[model samples]
Target: MDKFKKIDVEQLNIVDENGTVRLKLFNNQNIPPAIIDGEDILPGHRQSDPIAGMMFYNTEGDETGGLIYGSKKDEDGNYTTSGSLTFDQYKQDQVVQMEHNEENGKKNYGFSIYDRPNTNLREDIIKDKEIRDSKKSENEKIQELNKLWEGNVRRAFMGKNGDGDVIVQLSDSKGEPRIRMVVDQYDTPRMEFLDGEGNVLYKLPPEE
Candidate 1:
């Protein structure tokens, strides 16, 4: 045993015996990219990167998830910040996450789970994102994806919403909020049952 000493470091990476970066801690100026399957999918873009966080890698060097935080105030006097710890599905987007965010004077905190798709569905998602970002109307493309999204990656979340209300939301495969429960800042508890189209069909207290 030896006497402990203080250590100062802006970034640190813990690697496996094979030299795979299984864990990394970095500052905003040196944010690291996501590594997947021993390859970097999205890397830091120099000063443009706003994240100050640690990334976690899988045994194969793929990006399983990360914890990140960034905050800044623009010249216009608006403050923005967000922090999240996320877990990714194999070969897909985030499947679980704990997040807290604030923007435009609103704040949200919660945990969520996202269903993942198979290989074929993953390709569809990639294509759709590209189309959504193109200089074209996304209506048709959104509808197209909607048609294919049935029974795909659904989502559910429980959190305290921006208005300081506790909320639980469950979405259908089409990404429609089908069920919801809320406890507002005033401690009023309410529940809503919705149809497939997200139209509320009933309320726990029954509407007047």
Candidate 2:
């Protein structure tokens, strides 16, 4: 397809909403045809090899999407790899390390996902206290503001830092009427509410 090389975890896109996760797999390399061995590679590959370098997008919470590298099986094909990489042993060889970026305000949280077999790494995100605290605080503030509106509201992004502000976005119940709420270092938000046409509706008073 593109140029064959080690997987770039950044390019993979996974969007998940509710309990359903939408996974779109596109490789720069032509998926290696099929590994040979006695290999019904596709079938066995899906069961054993961990889908390497995957990005996760969690629409529901903090554990949205990121790069997946390590040992994993498509036991139920939740990831849709059954037809591509089929067996367990093939999956073993497929394991890889992945890098992920979690957006926070104007900054991003960067980390890696490692293969468990022979790859020892910390599994929890909280290991980075500063990043974890920022995400949690950001989520809470956004949730509070979400309850103020009657329509659909969402936290568009959360990054490490920038202009010393935290940004939260709101959309209509059906996800329109886009608005941005930027929280300052003191946790006060300077509001910029806009309509579907991107027109500013009005600005609210800063939080005291």
Candidate 3:
């Protein structure tokens, strides 16, 4: 079930003209015009499909928006809300799925938004090595690891001045890996890595 499940056209300003409906806007307010499928809503995307679904344009047409889907009960006690979006797994966009339950006049909305990139550790290894070798300019590499393995393990890295540093990695209950480097002051210039639990995982070899 996706999040865009429940909607009401009247609640969202979806108007009926002849047979086709269009979203109306206020003069001063700036928001994406919503798409209506009967009473269902489809929010516009921030990037692609700019003018296809719903048009929230100014005099010049600078569109910034996202999709919104919904569901609601009718006077006859029937519920309806619907819309859909296609996604490429590699595109790095998020998917939101939703489900709703209504009984005795009380409604419950449940949803999940998948926001993580699929794992290909082997491909990531080369990228990780590049980060390790590059002069430690930004914390992005470390942060990437943290985000990549979040909730699965504790990880850290340690290294030193010249060479011969061993990388240590550990996994938590979920078997996600985080790295640690162990190197001495005499090794090729590098910093020490420590895990969230403050455990030292790797130590670099002594400089020759």
Candidate 4:
């Protein structure tokens, strides 16, 4: 057994037997870009405003998911902080995540599950960048991007909102809330069932 009393490192990587990076821990300055299929996608984008965290990689060197956290305070006493743990779908974005976010005096924390399409995210990223850089109008670009990434949906969320309300929400496949249970800041508990159009079709108390 070997041990070092004091070790300081800005970045560290844990590699598998095949020399593939399985896990990486890094500081903001040393954060690595998102790597997929042995290629760095959107290089330099993450480094521009990096957060200190560790990233997980799959056997093929694709980013799986990671934990990230950071806090910053401006000179005027305003502050922002956030932390997140995520598990990504293969070749896609996060399918499950727990997150905490605070900006100024607002705070929100939640665990959520998402449904993503089978489309490869690497191709979507490249296409998104192209759409942004295209000569098309802003509205046209937005429409195209929306159509490109349509199947990404938040399926469920259970957490405290910025307004201090505890909420458990379940949505349909189209991302419409079908059920919502909440305990508001005032400690009033209520449950509601909604239609696809977001109309409250039923309530616990019958709305009497």
Q: Which model, 1 or 4, shows the larger TM-score?
A: 4
TM per prediction: 0.80, 0.27, 0.19, 0.91
For 137-167, candidate 1 gives per-residue lDDT tens digits of 6787777666656455547999988889999
lDDT of model 2 at position 51: 47
Error of 1 at 136 (Å): 12
Candidate number with greatest lDDT? 4
**Where does the lowest 10-residue lDDT sum fall in candidate 3?**
153-162
In candidate 1, stretches whose alpha carbon ends up further than 4 angstroms from where it belongs are 1-4, 43-47, 120-154
Which sections of candidate 4 miss by over 4 Å?
130-143
The local distance difference test score of model 3 is 0.38
Report how far off residue 44 is in candidate 2 (Å). Answer: 22
lDDT by residue (122-202, candidate 3, tens digit) is: 344446677767777669768876665443332222211123333343434343333334343354434334455655454
| Model 3 stretches with alpha carbons more than 4 Å out | 1-65, 70-75, 80-90, 93-104, 110-115, 118-208
Top TM-score model? 4
lDDT of 2: 0.38
Q: Whole-model Cα lDDT per candidate? A: 0.79, 0.38, 0.38, 0.92
